[model samples]
Target: MNTTRTVRLGLPILLLAATAGLVAAPAAEARSLPTYTCGYTLDQPQFDSVRGRECTASAGAPLIGHHWITFQMRNSGSGETWVCNSVEAALVPYYLDNKIDPDYADFERAYGRGADASVCHRLLD
Candidate 1:
C-alpha cells in the first residue's frame, strides 16, 4: 500500500520537474542575432560605393511592416562638407525588450547607419 502511494507522489514530482525543464530550455537556448550591413554613399553625380553594407545594432525605432531607412552619408572629400542620403527598402526588425544578449546587442546598436537587411532577427511577441 505504501509503495503504491509513494509511486503516485513520485511520478507527479518527476512530471513537474520535467515540465519546468522543458519550459526553460527554449529561453536559455534562444537563437542569436545574425550580422547585417547598411550602405553608405558619397555626394557625387555617380554615387560611388564608398563602403559596403556594414553590420550594426541600432534597434531603437519601432519597425512596422517593411521599414525604410535613410542614412546620411559622411563626406570624405577634401574639406568639402556634403550630405547624401540613401534609402534601404524593407528594413528588417531586429530587437526585443524581454531578453538582450550581453555578449552582443542586436544590429541596431552595432551597425548604426551601416546595416543592411541580410541579418535581421524577428522578435517574438
Candidate 2:
C-alpha cells in the first residue's frame, strides 16, 4: 500500500511570528546636547561654534565666514606673535544672503567683543 504523509507546521510558524510581534521594542537613545567650551582654537571654523559657547539659538545670529589671523604686532607692537581671532567675518563678501556683508565696526565687533576676546591665544603651533 502506497500512502502520502502531510506535515502541518504552518500553525507552529504562525504562533512563532505572533510571539515576535508581542516583544517590546528596544529603548531609543537620547540625543546628546551640544558640547560647550571656551574657544579651543584661535581659528573657530564655523560661526555657529562661537554661538554654541553662548547658548543661543543659532538662527538668532547671522551666520558668517571667518578665519584666524595672528597679529605680529598686537601690543608692545606685540610678541613673537599673539592675538588670534576669527576676524574675517567682516571681509566675507557674501554667504547665504549673497548680498552686502554686515558692516562690522571692527573684527572684534563681528561676533561681539566677549567672544572675540575668548580666542585661544596660545597653542602648539
Candidate 3:
C-alpha cells in the first residue's frame, strides 16, 4: 500500500519536471538573439562588384530585409561611395517604427539612384 502511494506522487513530480525542461528550452533560446548574415553588392557605371558580407541580429520585422540599406556613403566620385564596404562587418539595422522613413529614400537616392538598393552599411525594413 505504501509503495502504491509513493508511485502516484512520484509520477506527478516526474511529469512536472519534464514539462519545466521543455518550457525552459525555448525561453533560453529566446533570451539569446539569433544572428543573420547580410550580403553587400554594388554596381554602377564605373564600378561593379561584390563588396562583402555583414552580420545582423534583427528579428526581420523592423529593419532587416532583402535589400541592404545605406546609412553612410563613402564619398564616391559619382556618389556611389560604396559605404557599406568600410562599415563594420557586424551591424544593427535601422528600426523604421512601422512608418515611412524619409531617410530610407535618401539613402537609396544618394548611393546611385538604384531602384532596388544602394551602397551602404544598413539593410531595408
Candidate 4:
C-alpha cells in the first residue's frame, strides 16, 4: 500500500492500542520521582545495533518535529528512571506531522513499536 494510505489506515489502530495501554497505566505517585529519558537511533548502514538517540529537551517543550521520540520517566528522589509508553503514543502525530520526512518510513517504524513502554519518559515533579 502507499505510504499515505498505509498511515491513514494504520495510525488509528496504533493509536487505539496505545490508548488502551494507557488506561491501565499506573498513576504517578511518589514523594520524589526520578527523571528518566529515552530515544532511539536508526540502524546505520553497515552497523550492528541501533544507537541511543538520547532524546532530551526542556521541560514542557512540545515534541513536534520529524525525528525519533523518547520518554524518560526518572525518579527525582533517587535518580532512577524508566520509559512511559502512553506519552509516547500521545506524541506520535506530532512526530509524524513534524519530524518524519516525506518518506513516511520512519513514521511507520515508530508506529510499529508504539505500544512499547521502553520508549516512554514520565517526568515526576
Tens digit of lDDT per residue, candidate 3, span 27-63? 4444422222333334442442223233222343123
Clashes of each: 18, 1, 3, 23
Q: Which of candidates 1 and 4 is the stronger one according to TM-score? A: 1
Candidate 1, residue 61: lDDT: 28
Q: How would you encode candidate 4's per-residue C-alpha lDDT over 7-124 as one tens digit per residue? A: 9999999999999999989988853322223354332224222322244434553343333444444323344445433233223343455654545545544543322234343334
Question: Candidates 2 and 3: which is better by TM-score?
Answer: 3
Best by the lDDT measure: 4
User: What TM-score against the true fold does each predicted structure earn?
Assistant: 0.28, 0.21, 0.27, 0.21
lDDT of each: 0.37, 0.33, 0.38, 0.42
Candidate 1 residue-wise lDDT, 1-125, digit = tens: 99999999899999999999998775556533222233442333344322223323233422222234433222223322222233232233434353455333245432444322322222222
Candidate 3 clashes between residue pairs 3 or more apart in a chain or in different chains? 69-122, 69-123, 84-120
Error of 1 at 124 (Å): 17
Off by over 4 Å in 4: 1-36, 39-58, 66-90, 95-104, 108-125
Arranged by lDDT, best first: 4, 3, 1, 2
Q: Which runs in model 2 stand beyond 4 Å of their true positions? A: 1-23, 40-106, 109-125
RMSD of 1: 17.0
Best of the two (1, 2) by TM-score: 1
